[model samples]
Target: MKKFAEIDSINIKKNPFVVGSAVNPNKPEYTIYLLIKDDYLFIVDCGYFTNKRTKVSKWLTYQLEMPKAGLPWIVNTIENKFFKLSHEGGLPKDVYHYAEVVDGEKLMIDRPMFLGTRENPEPGYEIHTNSRKEGRTPKSLNFTDSFLFEHGLFDLFKDVAQKIESGEFS
Candidate 1:
């Protein structure tokens, strides 16, 4: 994995290569990987069942090859849904909407939820944990840390995506 940028202590990296699941779960688990090449930004979701893997992989490859002209739509969609203000000191009942079509199938991106209190604020952003997976035992690769603000992770991701789309960084 190539390091891209570190936002609010969260390191964004280029995961061009597929990685094995950190935890084995009864149900298929999902993980999102971010990558950038020149002016293009790629977002990949891994861990569908074997039956769905080929289709998902094809979709991801197509998405990775998409032109930068489509990036604005992605950034705007995420911003509108992700940057909304929520109730303080708790996870909001609202969920951010992010969906992509692959082989006519809709695949939704999992937006990190808000967690913890004002004094000990925590955003539900864990890159190496399979706790979010359904029917999976809570397991962590020990990659979690405390964060303040309801939209901390969302804001960081949005900012980086926007910057990359604008060609602000090489």
Candidate 2:
């Protein structure tokens, strides 16, 4: 199969084109590919199941395509968009929410719970991103879940999606 970097041109009308990719700095087994076709975005995990014959893309390739300064805003904007979308669906506005706690002698803070299981009882892992959300509820529209955050691929995915939406990458 063709690798992402080797793609020089794409017939987006026919198929989604690879816009960028990210690899987990901590886990080599985690990698993601971002693609766009028309106005929709798609992310594919090409990390665990691949063999020697399965082509993969590199995070460095995506970094090299854009200026370093663009990363922060791109990430923030994407997070904001995700937060808003989730909020509209009755999901919490915060992908992660912090709660304050008190110890007898000292105040303490708890780390934010990411898409806490309390909100959605079914396990997230039970459904692949490729599958539609259960009940096809409005919440399903908030498809970009905490998996991207936990995996450190959220910013990369957002940055790439922003670039594609801005017509900076086609």
Candidate 3:
């Protein structure tokens, strides 16, 4: 089995384009992304920021098992949202954790959104009260989608970790 270092490199692609004609009363939702192999479009994160009643959301799931021999590379993408707040970049343990997991990886790209987890208790959000008071604004942003990145995913992680521990890398 080859190590992460013994792998080829891949690049992320980016480009800018306008959505629609001016004064059309419809504007396209802008996005950022990284181009990986296999034409797999792993959208980082995207949504409307300016004045608009419309929005777009993205969610995906895949259970990709490593090859019996080994993986070509292990990519731990860091979503761009994390960089919006730079306070934790100073934490030693956070730095250590990322370093330990990466172990000199084949690639780490931060395109539209970062593609990995954060090491903190996320300041959670609840909106029943806000909507109750402010007439329920239709346009709001929820970065972490509930159905996609389920908070109830701890058990699943444990199961995967257990499999890895048992050398069940299929």
Per-residue lDDT of model 2, residues 121-163, tens digit only: 3212111211222255211112224555665556565666466
Q: How do the residues 21-65 of candidate 1 rate in per-residue lDDT, one tens digit apiece?
A: 122121124344444555444444444344455553312111122
Stretches > 4 Å off in candidate 3: 1-52, 55-97, 101-121, 124-150
lDDT of 2 at 67: 22
Question: Candidate 2 has what TM-score?
Answer: 0.35
> Candidate 1 local accuracy as lDDT?
0.36
- As for TM-score, the candidate ahead, 2 or 3, is 2
lDDT of 2 at 75: 46
Candidate lDDT (C-alpha), each? 0.36, 0.38, 0.24
Using lDDT as the measure, the top candidate is 2
Off by over 4 Å in 1: 1-28, 48-64, 78-157
Local error of candidate 3 at residue 46 (angstroms): 12
Query: Which residue pairs clash in candidate 3?
Result: 77-115, 78-114, 78-115, 79-113, 79-114, 79-115, 80-113, 80-114
Write model 3 residue lDDT over 74-150, tens digit each, in one string. Answer: 11112222333455443233331121212222122212232223542233211111111224432121222231235
TM-scores of all predicted structures: 0.31, 0.35, 0.24
